[model samples]
Target: MAKTVVITGGVSGMGLSASKLFLSKGWNVMIADFNKELGEKVYKELSSKYSKKQVAFQQTDVSNATSVTDLKTKTSQLFGKVDSVINNAGIFTKGALHEVAEDAWDRIMAIDVKSVYLMTKAFVPDMIEQKAGTIVNTASISGLTGDYNMAAYNAAKGALVNLVRAMALDYGKYGIRVNNINPGPTMTPMFKANPQSVIDTFKKASPLGKLAEPDDIARVMYFLASDESNPITGENIPVSAGFEIYSGQPVQK
Candidate 1:
């Protein structure tokens, strides 16, 4: 039987890129995102190329249990079983700890950190029963280190990284592998919001001398989701193009 994958926040950005890669590999894909317009748009685009039965979408608020439960049910109904899950749904916040408000902190944790818990709670049971599956969480380089003025985003991602580790340890015995993909500043909708100078600075800082494209990240995710990586678990792998070699290394004046 062909494989099936459930991708959260799969309507746009790196998630959308991952969706395309999985579909190209002949996998049934069920995408869940909060953006109804983008979700419908992606559904139409993919369904045009692949069978509608092989692609489905749900407008889901990942932070909500009800929405997550519905997503789980719909995915199972459409594809029968989920062999892989990409917990790529998240938001970024820019602010120092003192500057961020309680509401912003709550929202950051909800979408970035808590959603992982909710998703795992909803989906891992079947994987356990089947004794097989892969879970890939989108963490960040910032989670390992820290970025200026991004305390909330840093904290949430850091939590997600460790959560992947802890869960992998707990579930690996059941043939469920959990790992994290730590992407650097990628050229996604989220990073495109940066000013030209900011983008230039980041490009200069990167060892590759350019920001990553979404496919650059998706390809790594695809590998992790495949059986070739069955031996890998609890690994927080970085796809940062050597950004961590030393971020913002002195630029020529």
Candidate 2:
């Protein structure tokens, strides 16, 4: 049977990379993203190279329940069924807790934490009915530990990690596996938004001596969603190139 996977934020960055990888693995991809422009472009680009039936694009606002509901409906109509879902939509907020605006914190929670809940609420039932499925959440190194000026991002991702654990506990009996992928300083648009000095410092400090590529994280996501990782559930797999080993050390850059 052909597998189907839905990836939120699938238009760019790791999400886009994962989308492509999923297709190459013989799974149909429903590219769900808030960026309509990128979404359509990816859909068209992939359609040009593969069977149109193997790919789709849906503009999704994962933070909004109504939007997610509609996304689920349309995705079902287009793909018939979904075998896995990657909650990869997220935003970055930088500032001390005391200085961060309340709105910024809420936005982070909505897109990062609440979006996971909404995706689960909307998709888990179908997965339960099928009795076999996987859910992959995109967390961050900030979730495992913390970074300066990232109070909102850290809190939201921390909640996301715990949520994966809770989901695994509740749904394991139904054969549904839930896991989190914690990426470190990947070269995504989000990271590129930072100044070059900031980027250089993080790259030099990483044990790998460079920021991770989107494909680096995408491969792990694919593995977790594949049968190869059937025994692994509720695991927080860090793909951060040893960022945790010396998170306390300052890069001399």
Candidate 3:
């Protein structure tokens, strides 16, 4: 029998890549994302290529507890049980601390931090009951270090990093494993959404000549989700391609 996995924000970017990888690995993937149309399209694309039993999608807004609950219920109905979850739904905010709007900060926190809490709350019980599961959260390098004009995103991701550790400790005895991946300058939609000047500055700051692709992040997520990492838990693994170790330095002109 195929393992069942639920992925939040699986419609695009890193989540989408992870969904594809899991499907390739013979897991039944239940994708949850806010964009109903895109989610449906991706589901169709995957289902057309694979068996319908291997992939599905549920429209979800992870920031809403009700929606997350519905996602959990629907996923269980679609696929008997969920063996793993990827809490990858997140939003980014960039601005000077004083200039950042309160609503923007709240939105970022709600999606990046609160969503993890909600999803874990909704789905972890099943894992605990079954005495086996894995959780992979998408944090950011900003959470480990810091960067200018990313106060809210940094703070929320940092909170998520610690949350993963606490959950790992709390659930380890139940055979549940929790971990986080901190990606740096990934070439996702969020990265491209930044101002060109901001993007240029970030490009110059990284030791690597290019930003990471979504696959780079997704591959690490795959490892953490699989039994291959059965012994690993509570780890804040960095997928930054040496960017995490670089000191601030201007790119050579």
Candidate 4:
């Protein structure tokens, strides 16, 4: 029987790539995202490429505990049991620390951090019962370091890094693995949505001479989710293309 995997925010960006990779590897994929249109589109596209039984979608608002619970229930009903979960739903709230709105900070934290808690709570019981499972959280470089005009996003992602470690330590005895992937300046809808000048400036800052693509992060996720990384847990794997190692430098001309 094919292993079942659940991915939140699986309709776009790195989440979408992870979903496709798992499906290609013969895993049955259940993708959850807030955008019903994109969710349906991805499901249809994958279904056309693979069998309909190999792919599924559930409209989910990961920020809502009830919605996440419903997602888990529905996934179990369709796939019997989940073998892995990728907590990849997240958002960026752009604002400086002092000027950031209370509501914006709360909202970002709820989606980026609280969603992980809710998703883990909802799925870990089944994992414990089965005595095997993996959980991968999509954190960011901002989580490991500070960023300008990203107060809420930075804080939430930073919390996620530690949360992954704590989960790994607590659940290791149960045969459950928890880890985090921190990508730097990935080329995703969110990055493209930024002003062109801002994107250009960011690209020049990276030591690698360019921003990361979604596939760069997705490949790391695959390793963490697969048996190839079976002995690795409670770790933060930085997929930043050496951006983290670069010192302050003039923009590439």
| Candidate that would win on TM-score | 1
* Residue-level lDDT tens digits of model 1 in 198-248: 999989877679988999999999999999887999999999888876755
Model 4 residue 152 CA deviation in Å: 0.9
Evaluate residue 202 in candidate 4 and report its C-alpha lDDT on the 0 to 100 scale. 82
Per-residue C-alpha lDDT of model 3 across residues 157-248, encoded as one tens digit per residue: 99987988899999999999999999888888867998998888877866676678899898899999999997999999999866789666
lDDT of 4 at 24: 89
Q: Is candidate 2 or candidate 3 better by lDDT?
A: 2
How well is each residue in 40-117 modelled by candidate 4, as lDDT tens digits? 999999999998888899999999989999999999888899989999999888888888889988889899999999
lDDT of 4: 0.91
Candidate 3 regions with alpha-carbon error over 4 angstroms:
189-204, 249-253
Q: Candidate 1 regions off by >4 Å?
A: 247-253
Q: Name the 10 consecutive residues with the lowest summed lDDT in model 1.
A: 243-252
The number of residue pairs in model 2 that clash at the backbone is 0
When 1 and 2 are scored with lDDT, the better candidate is 1
Q: TM-scores of the models, in the given order?
A: 0.96, 0.95, 0.93, 0.94
Q: List the residue pairs that clash in candidate 1.
A: none
Candidate 1 has an lDDT of 0.93
Instruction: Give the range where candidate 4 is weakest over 10 consecutive residues by summed lDDT.
Output: 241-250
Residue 157 miss distance in model 1 (angstroms): 0.7
**Candidate of highest lDDT:** 1
